[model samples]
Target: MAAVLLTGTGVTWTYVASGGHRFDVADAPDAPVAVVFGAETKTPYLTGRLETTIALVKAGKVRSVLVSGNAAGSSGNETRAMTSYLLTHGVPMAEVVVDPYGVDTYDTCARAVQVYGLRRALLVTQPYHLPRAVSLCRSLGMDADGVNAQCACGGVNLFVNEAREWFATVLALKNAIWHRAPGVASLPH
Candidate 1:
């Protein structure tokens, strides 16, 4: 019981401290690159914040925007959704790269760095998701920071996801050390 309480508290604080920075993509002087992952259909906060990031690029602040995620169905194509959002906002279609195979946070960051030649990236997502995403990017040798999406419900929705991220961080680090990383398409067994 005590262990559970401490672990929960630790995870909660990790989200609060490391994930609270509201990153302005255009204003981050050292951060010229930005990457936003596509969330599932229920996560409107993901798309809403993506629009803001696109606006930064449209305004000439961010040099490039990499939208990473899978397009599983007609409605759930996260990469396409992000691309369309950016296009509607006047960001050139050429400036946006759609990664259709990034099915997870680790894959999204890994593919962005390895396949896309990204050296440094500002990851955009909800606050609870920042830790795992940043860790995966670092594990893959990309200098990474994160910008949290503004949630309509604010911190309330983070309760369950924060725990999931803690486990994901451990798994991502282990995978970086032990197994094949997430982004590569396997040649087949």
Candidate 2:
């Protein structure tokens, strides 16, 4: 069982290896959309992802944007916040796609395809989390690549995110086999 898990880890890591850092937008390919993973309200990490997504649109690295995060209407309604921020920054409302049902990274990657109809995207998030984001998004067949949004955030939050990612990576591998959609998962909106 341990061997199987390690193999799964290796496979997941291999899948995500296709994505890497873009030192500048000049090195990045233009995509139909930049999918910014949702984070908590007003945190530097989330801010970094959103700002990078906005930059991608403004710079023409991407033509559209998808903000995937918790839209459950209780605490983590980040899609609205992200969309508003994008709009104020000059991205047209029509160009922003919001997924409020992205309960976590797994949900975001899976639902980005099942719900948003994305064929290809530039996955936007910080470096520590980008690998899993890329792997999960691609493994689910979304034609996904990733950009490590420039984030200066650190301290306990950063440490927590890094630690959480290890477990999340394993869960993402299982999710690859489960192939459960948010609609089927029945997570609250």
Winning model by TM-score: 2
In the range 1-189, model 1's lDDT, one tens digit per residue, is 865665565455444434543455555434567788777654666665686676556556568888887777445677777788778878778777888878787788778877888987778877667766766676677877776666664465566665667656555655556646665432212
What is the TM-score of candidate 1? Answer: 0.76
Model 2 agreement with the true structure over 50-105: per-residue lDDT tens digits:
88888788788898888888766445568888898899889998898878777688
- Compared with the true structure, all predictions reach lDDT values of 0.68, 0.78
Which regions of candidate 1 fall more than 4 Å away from where they truly are? 1-27, 73-75, 154-158, 183-189
Query: Where does candidate 2 stray beyond 4 Å?
Result: 1-24, 73-75, 183-189
Query: Which pairs of residues collide in model 2?
Result: 71-100, 72-189
TM-score of 2: 0.85
Question: What's the distance in Å from true for residue 101, model 2?
Answer: 0.6
